[model samples]
Target: MYFAKRNSEEPEIVIENTVVYACESASCNGWMRKDFASENYVCPMCGSQLIEEVRELPKIQTDFNSFK
Candidate 1:
């Protein structure tokens, strides 16, 4: 099997750290943090809860034809 190039440029990959925080209020909405190490970070408004940090997956873009 062989693969074909969809675009002249290769796909870009980026990794980032994020945090998932559950809303303290009844709302299910949550928040994220790019860097957990950062000492500064608070919900946009009150009533929101801070949960735990999580790893964010990098966004990948590719042509469907490549799989064929």
Candidate 2:
């Protein structure tokens, strides 16, 4: 049996500085993107207060045509 070689190259991931709201509670691991967050900065998981911070995250690709 012969095997064929496949492309081993992996796609490059783009990283960007994104603003987010993170939970202040030490035990809670909750966060949300600033763009999608509401006026209330309360953590939905633990009901703790949220604080603004910047983090390096992978770039998200959005297709506007999908909304229609």
Candidate 3:
């Protein structure tokens, strides 16, 4: 007897691996990580400015049992 073929899952893609940082005006007190897909990010409180800090984050490789 013949068996049907099984499809395999696609590999995961690591898009952004850096931590984003932003700071708004002292009075505004509004800052957060901007979405990568977004065009412009502005502070909601004071509308000062939104800055992004991109840095290489460490990657850890382990066995499957690591999740346990």
Best by lDDT: 2
Against the unseen true structure, what C-alpha lDDT does each candidate score? 0.53, 0.90, 0.55
Candidate 2 per-residue lDDT over residues 1-68, each given as its tens digit? 99998879988999999999999999999999887788998999999999999999987766742564
Q: Estimate, for each residue in 1-68, the C-alpha lDDT of model 3 and write its tens digit.
A: 99988768766755557555454566664545433324566765666676776655544345742664
Candidate 1 per-residue C-alpha lDDT over 1-68 given as tens digits, one digit per residue, 9 for 90 to 100? 99986888886688755455544555545465443223444456664546565657664445842564
List candidate 1 segments past 4 Å from native.
1-7, 15-28, 34-42, 59-68
TM-scores, each model vs. reference: 0.35, 0.73, 0.34
Better of 1 and 2 by lDDT: 2
Error of 3 at 18 (Å): 5.4
Clashing pairs in 2: none
Displacement of the residue 22 alpha carbon in candidate 1, Å: 4.6
Best-fitting candidate, measured by TM-score?
Answer: 2
RMSD of 1: 11.9
What's the best-to-worst order under TM-score? 2, 1, 3
Deviation from truth (RMSD, Å), model 3: 12.2
lDDT score for residue 58 of model 1: 64
